[model samples]
Target: MAAGTGGRGRRWVTAASPVLLPVASAGLVLTLWWGAVVAFDIPRILLPGPAEVVSELIRLRHRLWEQGLVTLTETVVGFGITTVAGLLLGSAIAASRIVDQATTPWLVAFNAVPKVALAPMLVVWLNLGMQPRIAMVVLVSFFPVVLATSAGLRSTPVELVELARSWDASRWRTFAKVRFPYALPQIFMGLKIAMPLALIGAVVGEFAGGNTGLAFVIRTASAGGNTALAFAAIVVLSLMGIGLFYAVVALERLLLPWVRAVTA
Candidate 1:
């Protein structure tokens, strides 16, 4: 009876762990934050408590949503550009060492520069509109996709190449059947990495003095000395980042069943 009871208890834990763990973790974090605010008597200007932040978020929900939607739109547009352009460029570079040698330095150089420093130039070049925002997103997020997809293409097994050659496959056939599909895991890796970077790019673009976006909200709130509102904007930004990252993850799971088998 004791053995059966223990087995049932173990099964119950297994069932409950996924839901329980995150809830417990969030609860612990909130408790610590609330305790710190009360113990330190921290002023709202320096740092607002959870309650204050939540209240501010609720009070300004409509404005936050409107601005957040603009940010989200820019992020998505930029990510889309990164995806299409990166794949083409990565494939070309992977297929030809000459192309890789010619382009790799420029890509690395651009990435090495501070994105913030470039934001103003982008705004000037693309204009202080969604064009600049999308351009920044593409710049910030493209390198990872290009590099990872290139690496994955290069990493295709020699045996697989030999097999395709033996079967008298065309270059396009070999790629369509093997290279592109096999590279998806690495591609997805780049995408997941790029998602948050895209958000940052959008925010940076907004910092160049745009009229809409979460970054603008943050700046305006801070300037007005409404720290609670700034924190509220930051909370919205965090949620956007988390939501986008998981969206890519979900896409990976849906498209790549083999990842599960390979990892398993």
Candidate 2:
């Protein structure tokens, strides 16, 4: 019985290690940060300690929430648009050699252009407010989705396609039933890559010209010489990005349970 109990305890520890390890790592980093600040006697204005940043977080929680919401909206909306458009365009490109030949070069060229340089142009075209920000998110994130979708669809197994054709499956039926499902993993991989980019795009838009969002908060805080507040805003943005990325992961797991099972 004691041996069985020991085994169970070890299993429990192993099971919980994933969560515990990240928490411990984060704590260690924060401890190091705090110690460095204390040892160096860093000025609160130049490099506030972690405690100061946490205090700023609590003090300005409401303002952060409001700004964070704006950023979240821009990311979600832009990502959603990119997802739909990318899937459609990717499907088209995958389905037709002519479409692929005609569009691939243009898509590559557009993606190669510096996204940051386009932020100002987007602002000029869309005008101030969330429009440019959303556009920025879409622009920054669109390529990955399109590229992933096309690649995933094209990567669908030839054997599977032949089997479906032998079964007299219609093109749409084969795509819907076989190709799309098989491609979901790659497509989701792209989405995970794009999620952070979407947030960056939103922040870049805010940086270019905006009075709201976390980027704006950071800018204003730094301009006012409130380094702690700037750090706080940055922390919030990092957490938001992490949360959003995991949300996509959760979605992928939900939709592609088989992929996980196969990998496992």
Candidate 3:
């Protein structure tokens, strides 16, 4: 009984310990923000208080929800493309030394060009709809996935590979049973990195060219100098990013339960 109770207590402490510092820090920042608003006599147009922002959020709920959905769709589509292409490309490159070497310079050149500069060209080619936005998100995100997957594939234990060789495992069987599983943690690491970049890319693409989404609302509100509305849209966009990040974390938990146990 005592051992069980102790284990439960330890588990609680282990979870809460990590959360406490960040939560306390956030509280401190919010308190400072409230104080600064009063101390500086900040104008609403210049800097809305947290309460005002919350109120604006409530007021704009419907519009925010609609725009948020559009942004989410773009994020999902873009992230899907990035993951699929990255994995395939990573596998192909990892499986072939010649291909990896031949493509390295071209890949470097592609990554070198600023994505924003190409956003205009994307809009011209794919039009101003979801295609351009998805393309931009994929462009911003896939590099990390490719790099991480390649690294992970290379990280396979030589002993394990030799064991598979001794068993006369086919190349596809070896990859499926050993290399891909070994790469999953790194792949998730890449996903965590890609998620926010995808969100930002979607928003940037929308801002540059799209007729729909939170970015459009932000642009319109800013142009009208409706600072509160613009600020409200910005806040909604931030929340969307947060929600997407947590969604990825949740998926990581689900798809990689082994990761959770090991990480824990």
The root-mean-square deviation over C-alpha atoms between each candidate and the true structure, in angstroms, is 1.9, 1.2, 2.4
Model 2: per-residue Cα lDDT over 111-139, one tens digit each: 99988898888889999999999999999
- In candidate 3 the C-alpha lDDT for residue 100 amounts to 95
Winner on lDDT between 1 and 3 is 1
TM-score of 1: 0.94
Candidate 3 residue pairs in backbone clash:
none
TM-score, per-candidate, Cα-based: 0.94, 0.96, 0.90
Query: Highest lDDT among the candidates is held by which one?
Result: 2
Per-residue accuracy of model 1 over 1-264 as CA lDDT, tens digit each: 999999999999999997799789988998999999999998889889999999999998999999999999999999999999999999999999999999999999989999889889888887777998888899899999999999989889989988998999999999999888888999999989988999999999999867899999999999999998999999999999988999999899999977998795
Which regions of candidate 1 are displaced past 4 Å? Answer: 1-19
Ranked by lDDT from best down, the candidates are 2, 1, 3
TM-score, structure 3 vs. true: 0.90
The model with the greatest TM-score is 2
Q: Poorest 10 consecutive residues of model 2 by lDDT?
A: 255-264
Evaluate all candidate structures by whole-model CA lDDT and list the values in order: 0.92, 0.95, 0.87
